[model samples]
Target: MTNEASLGRVLEELGTTLLDVVCGDAKRSGDVGGVVIYDPLDEPELPANALVLGVGLHDPADLARVVTQLGAYGAAALVVRAPVAPDEELAAAARESGVAVLAFARGASWTHLAGMLRSLTADSGPDDAHTLGRIRSGDLFAVANSIAALLDAPVTIEDRNSRLVAFSSRQEATDPSRVQTILGRQVPEQYTRILEERGVFQAIYRSERPVFVAPLPVSDDAAQPPLPRTAIAVRAGDEILGTIWVIVPEPMSEERSQALYEAAQLVAMHMVWQRADADMERQLRAELVSTALQSGPGSLEAVRRLGLRDEPAVVLALTVVESAAEHALPAQLAAERKRLADAFAMHLTAAHPRAAAALIGDVAYGILPLLQEERAVLVATEFLARVGSRLRPLVGVGQLARDSSALARSRSGAERALRVLRSGSVSRQVALLDDVHVDALLIELADLVPRGDIPSGAVARIVAYDRENQTSLIETLRAWLDHFGDVAEASAAMYVHPNTFRYRLRRAAEVGRVDLKDADARLAAMLQLRLMKITDPGF
Candidate 1:
C-alpha cells in the first residue's frame, strides 16, 4: 500500500530481526527502486537508483569487489547476506567507495527476500499516472516546485549548453555552485570545468536514463556527506533540449524519481514551444529590418512597432570576409553564417532592447537605438569586442538618423562606409560614416563628373607638358601651392634649392600659358589641380 519503498522499509518489511547493518549505517535512508542478483559468471549492468545484491557468493573478497562495482555504477545501496562478524575489508571498501553496505541475517532465504523487496519496490501504477498527467498539463514550474517540495531539495532546469532556464524557489539549503549558477543564470566556466572533469556532462549526453553524480568534493571532511545530484535529459524524440537537475540530500523515492522523469518531458515541450516562438520573432525582426532598408512606406510603422519612434538610431553593417584557408563546405558555411546572424541579433537586442538586426546577404545589419550621438563609437567598439577575433568582420557605423524616415539614409551611409573600407582607403577594423564622409563625398562626386568637365586650361596644359616631357612640373606646382607660395618651404619640400624651385615654377607657368603675377590665376590653377587629382582617372 506504500507509494514507494526505501532500504529501511524493505528491511523492516522483511523483519528487522532478519538483517544486520555492518557498515553504511548513515545511508540507511537510501531509496530501493529495484533488485539485482549479482552473478560473478556474467558482466553486471547495474541500474543507478538502487541494487539489492543477493547472497550467492560467500567469499568476503568477492563481496568487496561487488560493492566496489555497484558503487562505481552509482547504485544507491547494496544488500547482502550477513557475515559471522563484521568484515573489515568489506566495510573499508564501502566507506571508501561511498556505497551503502547492508547485511541480511544469517541463513535468511535470498530468494524469498529478493522477491519480497521487488514486489514492495514495484512502480506505483496510479501515482505515476497521476504525476505524468500533471506534467502533461503544461505547467513545468509548478510540477518542478512540487517535486522540490516532495524531495525537500532545490531543482534547476538548464539548456543543453548548461545555461540555467529555471530553478525552484527553495534556497534555504544550497551550495556555492547553486547560488552562483542562479545568480548568473548559467553555470560558471570554472564549475563547468569541474563537472566536465568528473564526467557528469558526458554521462548525461550518453545516457537515456537518469544520471547520478556524486557530490563535488569541495570539502575534504569524510564525515560530511557530499551534495547528491541527479540529472535527466530533457528530450523531444531524439533531440535533447536541456536537462533537469535535482539536488538530493537522500536517494529519491520511486514516485519522486518518476515525477522527475515526467518533468523532463514537460521541460522538453516547453523548450520546443520557446524555440518556435523565438524563430517567429526573429523572422519578423529580419523582415522589419529589410523593409526599413528598402524605405517602403510601411517602414516607419515597422520601426515604431519595434519601439523606436522619435529616438535617434544608427545603422551598423558587419561584413564577413573569411580567409581562403577558412573555407568550409556549403552546408557548414551556411550554418555558421546563420549562427553569426543570430549572435548579432542577440547581442544587439541585449545592448538596446529596441534594436533590430538582420543578416542581409553576406552582411549583418543592425538598427541600433541610441540616446546620444557620442555613444556611437563606444557601441561600435563594444560590438567589435563581442564579435571577437574569430569572424574578423569589418564593422561600419552610419551616421545617426534622427527619425524613422531617415533610416534608409543611415543604412546607405553604413553601406558607403563598408565600400570605403573594402576600397583600401581605411585600414581600421571599424569605420564610422562621419570619419569617412569626405572620401565618400569625393568618390561620389568623382563618379558623377562628366568626362568633358575635367579641368582644362592651366591644369590640363601642365599635365600634358609633364606627360610629354616626362618632367616634374606638376609636382613643383603642387608643392609650391601646398606651402602657400613660400619659396623656402617649397624648395625644402622638393629637396631642391629655392632658386631651382623658382625656376621650375616659372617654367610651369610658361608651359601652362598662365601669368604667375596674377593671384586670381594662381588660385584658379591650384583649384584645378586639386579637382583633377580627385576626378581624373589618370591622376
Candidate 2:
C-alpha cells in the first residue's frame, strides 16, 4: 500500500527504468486521477510510470485536462495494480477518454520470487545443440526428462493400469530409485486420483473424472504437516496410456503451476513424436515410415524435410521377438543376437525388398511409409502370405491410417494379428483389419482339424453338452491348455486348480486323443470344439 507520490519520489532516485505503475483504486472511484510520468511534473521517459486513475473525472473538465496533460507527458499504458473502484464506471470513463486501462494484481511478496522468475525467464527449450533431431526412443526419453527438468520436480508417468512407465527428474541425476520402473504393478487407488480426474487412463475403462489426493507425507524423524501436491492425467486419445502426475510437496505459485501445465503439453508432444513414427507405419505404411526413418534435417526447424500431406495408404507392422536374456550373456549370445537380427533383416528384405523395412531388433519391420490405397487386407494377404511361407518368425498387419504420423497404431494391430497366428490355427497369412469378420473363419481353419478326424459318441455327447451349457470350449481348451499339458500356460490365464481342469481335460483328450501341445493338434481340437459349439446355437 505505498503511495503513488512517495513511489514517484523513489523512482526519481533509483532510476528504475521502463517500469509502469497504475492506481487500482481510481478505476472504481468514478473520478479520474491525474497522471504523471518520470518527474511527475517534469519529463516523461520510456521507462517512466504514468499514474492514471481507474475512476471517472472528479472535475469533468480537469479529467480532460489531466488526460491531455498525461499523454503529452508520456504514459505507455494504464495499469491497475488492484482496482478499488467499480469496474463499470471506471471502464466507461476510461473508454470515454480514449485511454487504455489494464488491471494486474500487485504480485504478492513471494519469498521465492527470484527462483520463480528465473523459471519464467529461463529458456524452456534445450540449447541449440540439444534441440530435437529425429525422434528416437532414447531421444524421446530425453525429451521426457527435459520436460521434467522444466518442471523442476520429480514426476512419474503411468500407463492406464497405473503402472509407472517413465519418471522425469533433473534433480537426481544418478539416483536409481527415481527412475525405478513400475510398469507391471498396480498403482494404489489412493495415489491414482490425479490421473483419474484428468481422464488420463480413465477412458480405457470407459469413464473418467478429475480426482485429487492428499500429498503423500514423507516419513522422517521430524513431525509437521507435509506439502500439498497436484497431478494431471493424460491419455492417448481415448486409449488410456496412463497419467502424468506432477507432485509438489507444497502448493505451486500460479505462475509455476501454469508453467507446469505448459510443460505437460510439451510431454504430450514428445509422446506423439516418439509413438507417431510407429503409428504411421500401421496406417500410412511405407511412405510415412520412409519419410520418418529416412534421414534428413532432423530438427523441427528444417522445414523442407518432407512435405508429407495426408494420402491414402495401407499399414503393416512386423515384430521381431528376440530373447533379451538369451542375447545378454557374456558368451555367444551376443553374437547369436546379431546373427538373428541379420537373418530377420535378410528375410524381410527378401519379402518386399522394395518396401519400407528397418531392422528393429530380432524383428525387422517396414513402414512402407508411402502407398496409394487404404485396403491393407488384400495387400497384406498377397505380400505376407508369401513372406510367412519363408520366414521362421511371424508378422501381423493392421488397418490403414489416413494420417501418416499415426503409423505406430499398426504395431498394436500387428501384435494382435500375430497373437491370432500364434493360436496355431493358421499358417503364415495376412491379418487385415477386416479379419475381425473372420470369427467363424478363425474357427474354421482346415489345418486345425486332423486328417479325417472323427469324434466318438461319448466325446460327441460331452461336446454337445458343453455347447448346450453355453460354455466356450475354444476358450476353455485354450484356458486348460490340453488338460494342463506340461507345455501349457493354463496356470497363468485361468487361475484354475490344475487337477480339476485335468479331469475334464482327460475326458476331452479321450474324445479325440488330441495332443494339445502339438501345433496341428491344438488347432484341430480347437476348431472341432468351436464348430460343435457354434452349430449348437442354444449353447
Candidate 3:
C-alpha cells in the first residue's frame, strides 16, 4: 500500500504543506516530503470521542500537536505516516512520542489519498449565514416545492440531518403525515439470501451525478409519477443547508436532470427572498403597534398635524363594527384616527365606554379634526345609518385640544356629549362639548325639566323669539331663572343692566301671555326657563 513516490508527487500537485504523514511502521517513516501519511487508513472513530484533534491535518508537526491535544483528553493512540522527505528531525520526534504510535511503511496510495482529502474537506466550507448567504426556513420551504415542480419530479426538501420541510406531490398531497414520512428518507427495504447485496441508497453522493439509486424498493405511484433516483444537496453559499430528494420513477434524461438542478437553484433563491419579506413584515407590524401605544391617530397632536383648521370636527364612536384579532385593535384605532383626520381634520380621539365613542377601545378613536358644525352632526347621522337599529351613537365636539397632553380631557368632553345624546331620547343626536361645558349648570336643571313639559304658549313664545331675536333666549332665560328672577341679580349675573333685563322679561311675558308677577305665571316661567337653559347650540 505504500507508494511514497506516487503519493509525494500527488501532494506536490496540490502544493499543500498541511499534511500529517503517520506510520505504523518505522521503516516507512524515513523518506517523505511535507505532510505525508504512512499509517493504515483503518482506525477507531475518535473525533468527538476526544476533546480535540480535529482537521486530521497532514503535516507532522500539526499532527503532533493534535496528538498531544487528544492525549490530554484521553486518546488511546497516535497514527503517523512518512511523507517522501529528508526531514529527519520530525521522524525522530515521532518515534520518541509516548502514545501508542502506529507507523505504517505502506498504506493507501497517494492517488487515493488525493481523492479522499477532497471529500473530507467538504464540510469545512466557509459559508455561514451571518458571514455568507443563508436561507431562511420559510423561503426554503417555498423553493423546495418550486424546484420539485420544475424537475418533472416530486421533490421533497429536507433540512440538515434529513428532516422533511417542504415538497411537491406526485401522489396525493393530503395525508401530510405520510407525505412527510416519504419526503427525505426512504423506508429501508428487506433483503434475502438469494438477492445480491444492495447498494447503499446514498451511494450516489460520492459521484457528480444528479440522482442516486435509493437503497430500498420504492415504486412510483400510478406507474408514472416522478423519480427519487437523484438528490441535490442544498447549499447556502458554500455551506450545505440540506438535501432535495427528486422522485424519478425511473432514470431521467440528462436534460431533465439538468433542469431539476436549475430548479433547485431557483428554490434556494426563492427561500432567501421569502425570508427577507416575512422578516420585514413582522418588523413593520411591530412598528405599527408601537405607534398605537405611544398615541393613536386620533390624539390631539395627531389631529393638529392633520392640518385641517376649518373643517367641522366632532368625536363620534364606532358601534356594531366587526373586528379580527385584538392585536389589530390599535391599528384599527390608528386607521380610524387617520381617516377622521383626513376627513374631519383629526378632531377625534379614542374614547372610553360610558364615556362616548363606542368601540374606541376595540376599534377606533376618532379625531374629527376639521369638521364644521353641520358636518359633525352629519357624521353622527351617517354612523347611525350604518349601524341601523342595532346601535346608537353619540357625538360631541369641543374646542380642539391644543395638544396631545389635553387629549385625555378632550376625550372626556366627547364622552359628556355622548352622555347628553344618550341621556336624552333621540336617534343620532349630536352635541358639542363646548355647549356641554358651558351649559353644565343648565344641564342639571334641564334634567329636572319634564319632557314636553313646557306650557304650549311658553313654547310658542320661545320659538317666536328665536325666529325674531338673533340671540339665543334659551340661555338667557335659563340664566334668569338661575339667578332667581331678581331683576337686579339676574341682570348683574348676565352682565346686563336691570332695566334691560326688565325689558327682556316683559317681552318674555308678552310672548307667553302670562303675568310676570302672578304665582302660576312665575311657576310656568321657571319651567320654561329650566327647559331653555338646556339650550340647543344651533339656536
Q: Highest TM-score among the candidates is held by which one? A: 1
Per-residue alpha-carbon lDDT of candidate 2 for residues 1-539, written as tens digits (9 for 90 to 100): 11122223222211111123332222232222223211233232222333333222343344334444445544323533343243455444455554444432333211111111211122222333223433332233344455556667656665556654454443223222222222112355644565456553434244333233354434575344433445555545654445565555565667766765565555555556546643443344334344453223331111123323344334455443333233333344334434433333333322222234544433345443334333344444444333322123445665454544455455545555655554544545455545643642544453475654534343454566567776444345655644445424674456556675566566556544566557776665655555554344333
Instruction: Name the best candidate (by lDDT).
Output: 1
Candidate 1: residue 533 Cα off by (Å): 17
Better of 2 and 3 by lDDT: 3
Tell me the tens digit of each residue's lDDT in model 1 across 1-539.
Answer: 22256666554433334455667643456466456656565455554556546456667787778778877876666776666344899888878776667766554445435444554564443543333335432334445566576667778878888876656656436666775665455787886888899888889878876787778776565444447788888898988788888887665677777877776776777667656655666677778788886667898777776656656788888776554357656665566667667666655654554577888777788888775544656666765675544435676888788877778888998888876665555667678888888767766765787887767888788888998999999899989888888999999999999999999999999999988778998888776665676665356
Model 2 global lDDT (CA atoms, 0 to 1)? 0.42
lDDT of 1: 0.69
Q: TM-score-based ranking, best first?
A: 1, 2, 3
Candidate achieving higher TM-score, 2 or 3: 2
lDDT of 3 at 296: 59
Candidates 1 and 3 compared by lDDT, better number: 1
For residues 1-539, could you state the per-residue lDDT of candidate 3 as single tens digits?
12122233222222222233343222222212112222222232232211111223456666655455444533333433444342444444444442233332233233223222321221221333222124323434335445655665555665555544454544343233234244213221222111125533234333334656543443555333322356665555765555666655566788887776666566556556445754564344334322322345543333333322323333443322222223335565455543332222111211100111223332234544332544555545544443323222345544454434444554556656655555452333566666555344446666676776543576567667766876555455656666667678778888887887777766666766766567786676676554554544333
Q: Model 1, residue 305: what's the lDDT?
A: 63
Candidates, ranked, lDDT? 1, 3, 2
